[model samples]
Target: METTDFSQPIRQSAKGIIVIFAFNLVTFVKKFFVLFIAFGVSILRSKSIGNVTPTMMVLAVIGVLLIILIIAILKYLNFKFYLSKDDFHLATGIINKDNTIIPKSKIQNVYIKQNFLQQIINVVSVKIETAGDKKSEIEISALDKPTALLLKKKLFRKASSVSEELEQSESIEEPEVFFKVTPKRLLLEGLSQNHFKSFLLIFTFGFGLYSEFKDFLQELELEKHVEGLVELDEATILNLIITNVIILIGVVLISFLFSVVKTFIINFNLEVVEHQKTIEINKGLFNKVSLSLTPSRIQNLVITTNRVKQYFGLHTIAVKQAMVNVKQQKNFNIVALEKEQLDYLVNKLLSNYNDEQGDVAKPRPYFMRISALEMFLFGVVINGLSLAIFGIEMLWINAVFMPLAALYVYFAYKKAYYRISEDFVTIGSGVIDTTTNILEIHKIQSVKLKQTIFQRPRAIASLVISTASKSVTIPYISKSEAISIYNLLLYKVESQDRDWM
Candidate 1:
């Protein structure tokens, strides 16, 4: 594989760091304000709010200003960046210069962002990401857009070649026009689906109303100072309930509308293109993110089915890759599809492969029953503690909740289980909201077996399989079974001579 050095351009751009200093100045000012607020609040709560001494106030102000100025001066004096043959380097700081090197082979993606100001100035911001950190590998604030893109492409090519060697397989196929969520489907999904944002909005509105009513009641001191501000008659009670119900309905409707608008904007012009060796996803009206990933990078696949969707026999599949930086990785890389479409896509990603036998390991039925017992005990302890904290006012609630809690715990534990197959590992869990994760053998990085005191008596244990970026744990298994899986994984890693990452 061939690589290009980006050292000269990065170094040249780093000199005379006026802009860098200015950015740091703004950051320092923000931090200073935060500190000021915290200090002022602390002092005000303990003593007279308006009795702050002039000396103290002047000293605080001077301290904030000095800190900001010192940071700005350092930034102006010490910022620098350069490119190495296989990596890029950045050095900054006046007193103790910090050096960072990002290997080209680890580069996952590169991005260019330009706001209205950048468009006018003919300069762009460049962000390079690698599988090293959740933050950007390097951020170049101002650069000629064409030159930046050229450099990004050159690095991407080098990274892709190295990744190909690692996979040791021919390039994966990319479809010309892959499946996409259209405007109509997006709208339908939003209205029919129970999205996180929708529930959050509903919760917010309800909580706000409750808080305001509670505050107003406290201020009125109704029981202590009963006044006829608003007559508490039958008409008043009826009106209050009706108004609250109307508000709740409105909240639901508004939540649905917000979801629809968000879905429409995000999936607008959504497209996924597959190349011979990689897949590229492009979409979004604002703050767009373009992600490219090879099939071999995928660590696990999750298929989720909600109650309503389950009734319709529909499921949404999310493809998870082992990118070290979760934030820098792609969203919607896990596309929603019908069952057949989902199966087809999974097959394509997996491709034709030899079915190497997986090490045998199975949790016995008794282990699952024990898991249920543990869950029930946990619920009892938690509710018991809550009752002690809240007193008799909550005693009645706990009495009614006892059985329900036990049942829930029992179901939760009963649902938790795992199975190792010839080429993959499957874990199923959840009581009210069940989910099964399917992970390929090659995707696993490490396997751990653990035994608790109670589990030791029963010869039961737990297994945690770690991927490049995520971990899935099986709560209850036999100790012997856990050992078998761990040993197999150790053997595979050593034989391959490649880090799980």
Candidate 2:
């Protein structure tokens, strides 16, 4: 193990001052946007009233920049981090000092990222995330690439060594490169993205732009002229339809282009490598990101594909990690894989990958019965409400949906299934877009079985399997079956010596 001198505090790269200043400025603006706007307006008013000259305004800007620079310098001076054999320690803050010590075992992920600025400076930001924290426990804004890589390797080594000691075993298997996203595959993935989502995004952006334009026109007292130029009432019905068609085509094109560009940028040169104990992912274009995670840390795995992607024989895999009360979103998802590759990756990455070979268990016949009854009741209530609010005519209109509701219920009941194996449990559900959630049995935090008053009469129960991050439920199963699965999961949780992150 590489030993570092702990007597001296390890400071960030000199480029960190610039990064800190920018970060502080962004924080200041975000926290007090109204204040910033008010300040700007006041300055403009003063200048217009001849109370402040252009030179004075320039001086004010320079003064603010100087103050920010001094604050950044102070922060840089105060901020320091050093790694001990067992723990990583950080000391930060200028006025309110904070000293944090995080044990090696608690560290769930270590990420190195570089934004455009940091990339230009040849420095990367390091984020050390703990198991339960929403944000990184420690963040080094700027570190040389080599230093960051060394620190990451050291921390991971310390963590792995401790685990090996506890288990009294070590695996010397060579790391394998599982998958890499080529430019063509990336383009396919981008094209396969949900068009509805892209359309909505484009619609929102267009609406916002239109609103801003309207506001600008109103400010300039040219609203009437703008309205005259695009008179809606003067257009014929045919002209209106043609115009709308053209607009819709334009919007869809823009949305598609934006989605393709964004996806390409985000997933550029994506690569996935797997070691005996961990999986590492590297990707991104403008802002490069590298992440490492152990299989034990994964709460569940979701493999998703739409009709188009299915036709293309591609799937996107996402792993959910144990995040207790973490509000921040993590971008650890991977995209564009063939079924064979997906199976290979799963087999190599998950300890319980063979669980899929086990017999799949579908919900009992009572599930369909209960679903039908529920749908009928729901329809009755909806029709009743419609009748009360808008008379018999509305009730008749809603009555048309009663059969559709029943069909939906039947499909849902048919799709719901759960399977358990020695080491993992898989829950499969969804109607239009199917989803299968695979979770390691040892990682299950809790298993809940509940029977409603209506369900109890039929001896049917709902089972909820929960992890640190999310819960998966299998509804309308036989009460006895639910109990058996729950007990088995509990046993796995108790008996397994495996660490869940």
In model 2, the worst 10-residue window by lDDT is: 322-331
- Which runs of model 1 end up more than 4 angstroms from their true locations? 1-26, 35-85, 89-101, 111-125, 133-136, 142-149, 162-177, 188-215, 218-240, 243-270, 309-323, 329-335, 352-417, 431-434, 496-501
Q: Estimate each model's TM-score.
A: 0.68, 0.81
Tens digit of per-residue lDDT, candidate 2, span 1-501: 454454367899889999999988888768878976786797677664356666776787788888989999999999898888889999999999999988887787788999888888889999888876565567899988878888887788777665656333334566678889888887888887787788998898987897879877576656555665666655655666997899999999888888889888888888998766678888889989988867767788887776678888778777788763342234677888888988877765685487446689998888777677777798888888888868887966655787788667777777788888778788888654557788888778888888899888888999988887789888888899888887878877888777676
Choose the strongest candidate by lDDT.
2
Q: lDDT for model 1, please.
A: 0.64
**Cα lDDT, model 1, residue 100:** 77
The worst-scoring run of ten residues by lDDT in candidate 1 lies at 353-362
Per-residue alpha-carbon lDDT of candidate 1 for residues 263-309, written as tens digits (9 for 90 to 100):
66665556666655566666565544445655666777676655655
Kindly provide the TM-score of model 2 when superposed on the true structure, using C-alpha atoms.
0.81
Kindly provide the TM-score of model 1 when superposed on the true structure, using C-alpha atoms.
0.68
Candidate models: Cα lDDT each? 0.64, 0.79
